[model samples]
Target chain A: MTIRYPNGKLYTPHTSVQKTEKKSKSKDLSFSNRGKTLEDEINEANDYYIKRRLAIIHKKPVPVQIVKVEYPSRSAAVIREAYFRTPSTTDYNGVWNGHYIDFDAKETASKTSFPLKNIHEHQMTHMQQVTEQNGVAFIIVRFSAFERYFIVPYEVLQKAWQAMENGNRKSIPFSTIEEEAYEIPTSYYPRIDYLPIIQQLIVEKCCGFESEEK
Target chain B: MTIRYPNGKLYTPHTSVQKTEKKSKSKDLSFSNRGKTLEDEINEANDYYIKRRLAIIHKKPVPVQIVKVEYPSRSAAVIREAYFRTPSTTDYNGVWNGHYIDFDAKETASKTSFPLKNIHEHQMTHMQQVTEQNGVAFIIVRFSAFERYFIVPYEVLQKAWQAMENGNRKSIPFSTIEEEAYEIPTSYYPRIDYLPIIQQLIVEKCCGFESEEK
Candidate 1:
C-alpha cells in the first residue's frame, strides 16, 4: 500500500526491502515489523517525554502558503487553495531543561549509507546558527532497512556536509555513522527515547569533554 | 480596506481609532501611522536579529489540516481543501543564548484592557509547560489604540488567566499591564526591539534579581 502525505507527496514504505525476508543480520531489524515511519516514532517519544516532564519538544507544523480561503461562517474557515512552502528551519525543536534543542529527523532506505541529499542547505545553516548560540543541535537519522536509529551531532553532520560540498563523498557510510553517532536503543513506551543522548551532549558541551575525548 | 488572514479571519487594522484623529496622549501613538501589523513588525525584528547574529527566533507556520490535494505535476502539489487547526503551542519560539524563548504575539484594539478571548487555552497550557521546564516564556501584546507594546511574562499571563478561570476578571486591565509588563520601544531597523527585555529576563532568572528588586 502507498501512503500520501498532506502535501501530496508519495510515501512508499520499505520499497527496497523484500516482504518475504525472514532473517536479518541485526536484531534491531525484527522491530521493523511494526512498519511505523520514523516521524511517528519520534512524535510518540516526544509525547512520552512531555507527559513525564522529562522534556518539551515538538514537531513544527508543515509550512504552507495559503492563497485562497472561504469563510462559511464566523467560526468556520476553509482553505480553498494553498501551496507547501520550503521550511526555513528544521522539523523539530523545543526546550529541554532550559537548554534549547533543535533537530531534524530523516529516514533512508539505503542499507550502507545515509545520503546528504536528505538534508537541505537552509537546515544546515539553521543548525549551525543554533549551535553557535550554544543550543543543542543534532539530526536523528533512521536506517529503515535495519531499523537502526542514530543521533548525529551537528558537528559530525557539518564535517560530512563540508566534505560533500568539496566534491567528496555524497553520503556518509554506515560505518562512519556507527563510529561518530550515538545509537538510540528502541523501546515500547517511548519508541525513540533520544533525550538521554541530548543530556550527554549538554554535559560534553559544558565540560569541553568532546575535545578532550578526541 | 479589509484584510483577511490566510485562515479567513478579518483583520481590521485600527478599527476603533478614528482616521482623522491627530492628537494622542502618548508619543508612541505617532509611530502607529506607519500602519504595520504587530506580526509584521515582529517578523522584521526577528529577521534583523538573525542577520546580525543577535538571536534566532521564528513564528511557526499556520497549522492547516489538508483534506484533499491535487498533484498538477511531479514538482507542483496544490492543496484543494484544508482547514485551519488550532495551534497547540505559542506562535513564536527559538533559542537566544542557550535559553529557550517562547512567546505569542497579540494585538488588541481596546485601550482599556486586553481581552482574555484573544488567547487560547492550549496556548496558555503550552506556555505553562515551557516555563515549568525552566524555559523563558512571555507574550508580546500590542494595544493598537495607543500603539503601545508590552512584553508580559508568562507568570503575569498565568495570573490573569487563572483569575479569568475563577470568574474574577475576564481581561487584564491596561493599568495592570503597564505595571507588570515591559514596554518595547519602537525602532527603525528591527522595528520592535524586544530582545533587550529578554536579556534582562535571563539576568533576573539566573541571579534572582527580580525578587531582590521587588
Candidate 2:
C-alpha cells in the first residue's frame, strides 16, 4: 500500500510495526481502532482543537543537528547528514486562555506500571521549571494494552521523581497513576480531549495552598 | 580552521555565508559585530535571560522532514536524508512573566524601508491570532546598514498588512518604524535587550484602552 504524508509525499511503512509485532500485536489492536499510535491520535486532537480555536498548542519540531547539506539548486537545499537531537523540553507546549501549557505524551505496553524510563530527567526538570513559572505542566501516558490515557500533573510527577531520586521505586505503580491522574476519554474528533482536565487542574491550583498544604 | 558547533561537533561552513558574501559583503559586515548576527545576539540574550531566570524563551527548531534514517547503533540514529521543512509560525516564542510571547526576528540590509517580503503572510496571520488571544506578538526588525533594531508591535504590523492588501506601499518606511516602534538597546551579555521594551508594551496595554482608544 502506498502511504502518503500530509505533504503528498510517499512514505515508507513505519519500522516499529515490524519490531514490535510479535510482542505488541494484541496490545496495539486493543488500543487503536485504526492503526494510529498514541502520538498520532494526540496530533489529530491538537489539529481539531486548533481548527476550533480551542487552543494554540503545537508539537515542537524534532531538533536535529545538521552536519552536511547539499544545495542541488538555488532554492532547494537538502540535509545530507544530521543527527537526532536529545530534546531538553517537552514535546508539546502552547498558550491556553493566557496560561502556558507544557507536556509530553508517552505510551507504555506495561499494564502493571508506567516505567520512569519513558521520561527523561531533563524533561522532568523542565516540567518543574514550567510549574514554578505559573504554567500548567503534565504528562499524558497511554496504557496501550488497556487503552487508558491519563494526565499526570507535574506536582504528582515531581513527588514521584523526588522519591526515585531518594532511592524509592523507579516506576510509578498503575494504582498510583489511577488514583492521582485525571483520565481522559477517547472520542472521534479530539480523540484524547485533555483541556477539560487541564481546566480542572488550573482551577484547583488557583485555590491557593489550602489543598496543597493539606 | 575547524568549525565547532555548540555541541562540539565539527560543522561545515554554512552555504548561506558563501552565497550572501557575494551579494552583500558590506551589508553583512555593517550589522554583525564579532561575527555575530542579530539572531545570534538574540540567542545569546535568551541564554542570559534563562540563566538569570528572567524569562523562558526559545528559538523554535528548524523543522525538517526526515526521509531516511540509519541506526548505526542501538542508541545513535543518523538521518541519512532530510529536507528543511517550511515553518508556519514565527521563529521565537515562550512564556514571559505569565504572558505568552511570540515573535519573529528579521534582518534587512535596506535602510530606507523594511520590505514586506521579509515577513510572510502566514506568519502575520499567526501573529494576528496570537494578538487576539491576548498573547504578546511582535516582530524584531534589524536595520543592518543603520545598526538599528525596532520592536514593531502586532497592532502596527496588522494595520500595515491590511493597508498593503488594499494597494498601499509594500514596505514600512524606516522613518515610520522609528516613530511607531520601540527601540531596543544593545548590551554586553544580552546584546539585544528586548524584554524591557516588552514589559513597557505590557504596561501600556494594561492601561484600560485609554491610549488605544485615543
Candidate 3:
C-alpha cells in the first residue's frame, strides 16, 4: 500500500511487515522491528493511551484543498482533484489531566544535530501561542540514526529558533538536545511513553502541585 | 466556487457576497448580513480570538483517504483519487486560559427542537472522553430558523443522548435548551464570541477560581 504523507510525499513501505512477522516469532523486542516512522509510533501510543484512559491525544488530519468532487450516490462521494494545504498548526494536540497538550513529531537522520529547517515558522508561532495560553507545548524529536527520542519544550525550542533568526547555528546540536530536552525511553506497549514526562513538567510548572488522576 | 464540507457535501454560495456588499452600504448590522453558516462564523470567531490573543482554537481538517496521486513536479502533487473518512472527534478544539476546550458546531432548521440525529455516536463518545479528562466539552447549536445560538454543555447533551438511546425522545426540545444552555448574543465582530462563555464555564467547573487574564 502507498501511504500519503502530510507533505504530499508517497512512501512505499519496505518488506518490513514480513520482517516484523518473522521477528515476532522470536517473542522478543528486536531493535530490527523498530522500522515504523515517528508519526506512526506516536499514533499507536495515542491509541494505547486512549484505551487505558490515560489521555486523549490525536493527530490532526492532513489538510487538503478539494477542487472537484464527484458524488455517485447519496452516500459515496469521490474526490477527483485535490491539493495538499500547508497546515496552520502542529500535528498532534489534546487534553491530558485537564491541561492542553500540543506538539509536533519530527525525526532527523543526522546523528549530530536536528536541523531548524525541520520546524516551520507557523508551527513555531502556534507553539508560542499555546505556551502563552499556559498550555503545554513541545516537540518530540527522534534522532533516527541513534534511535534516541527527546521531548523538547517550547521555551527551549523558541530560544534556539530566535538564536537561529539572529544569525546563530541553523541546527540544534545533539549535545544541546541531550541537555535541554527530556529523553523518552523506548517501550513496547505505548511505543514512546512521553506522557509521564509531560506529567512531571506539568507538576513542576504548576509549582509542584500535582493534578489528581482520574 | 464550490466548498467541500467534512461530510463531502458541496456548498455553492448564493450571491451572499453581493448581498453582503450591498448591506455594507447601509453601515448598520443588518440581520441580512447573518447569512454565513455556523461553521464559517465559528472559524471567523476563532480568527478574531487568535488576533486578540484571547484564545487559540481551530477546526480540524476534513479527513480524507487518498488512494492515488500524480506527482506532476517536485513541488506540486495532485490527488487523483480520494474518499472522505468519518471524523472520530469533534470539529473544533483548543486551549483557553490553561483549559482544554473541545466542541462541535451544529445547526438546526427545526424551530421546535434540535434532533439527536444531528450528532453521531462517535462524537458523543469523544466528548465523553474529553470531559473525563476534565476538559471542557460542549456543542454550539445554531437555531437557524430562530436566529438563536446556544452553547450546550456536554453533560446536558449526554443526558439527552442517553434518553434517546433508552428509546425516549429522539430530539431535544428547544425549551429545554433555552432553560439549560447559555445563550450567546449575536455580534458583528467575532460572530460567535464563545470564549467568554467558555471562561465562565471554566470558572464554574474550577470551583469559582478564575484563571488570570494574560
**Model 3 agreement with the true structure over B1-214: per-residue lDDT tens digits:** 3444456765443332222223322333343335566777888899998988999999999999999999996668999999999999999999988999999998777778989898999999999999999999999998766667899999889999999989999999999998878888665566678888888777777886544541
lDDT of 3: 0.83
* lDDT per residue as tens, model 2, A1-214: 3535456776442323332323433335445444667677778888887777777778889999999999986677889899988887898888778778889998887768888888998898778767766778899997766767899998888888889989999889999998888888655455678888888778777875334422
lDDT of candidate 1 over A1-214, digit per residue (tens): 3545456776444435532123332234345436556777888899998898888899999999999999996667999999999999999999988999999998777778999999999999999999988888899998878677899999999999999989999999999998888888665546677999889878887987873333
Question: Candidate 3: which stretches are off by over 4 Å?
Answer: A1-32, A208-214, B1-32, B208-214
Residue B10 in model 3: shift from native, Å?
A: 33
Give the per-residue lDDT of model 3 (tens digit) for A187-209: 55566788998988787778955
TM-score-best of 1 and 2: 1
Best by DockQ: 3
Stretches off by above 4 angstroms in model 2 are A1-33, A209-214, B1-32, B73-75, B209-214
- Score residue B139 of candidate 1 by CA lDDT: 94
User: lDDT of each prediction vs. the true structure?
Assistant: 0.83, 0.78, 0.83
lDDT of 2 by residue, B76-106 (tens): 8889899998787898888777788889998
Which residues of candidate 1, in runs, are more than 4 Å off?
A1-33, A73-75, A210-214, B1-33, B211-214
The pairs that clash in candidate 2 are none
Q: After superposition, how far is residue B120 of candidate 1 from its true place, in Å?
A: 0.9
Q: Write the per-residue lDDT of candidate 1 for residues B1-214, one digit (tens) a residue.
A: 3545556776444445632122322234334435556777898899988998889999999999999999986667999999999899999999999999999998777778999898999988899999989999999998877767899999998999998889899999999998888888765546679999889878887887784433
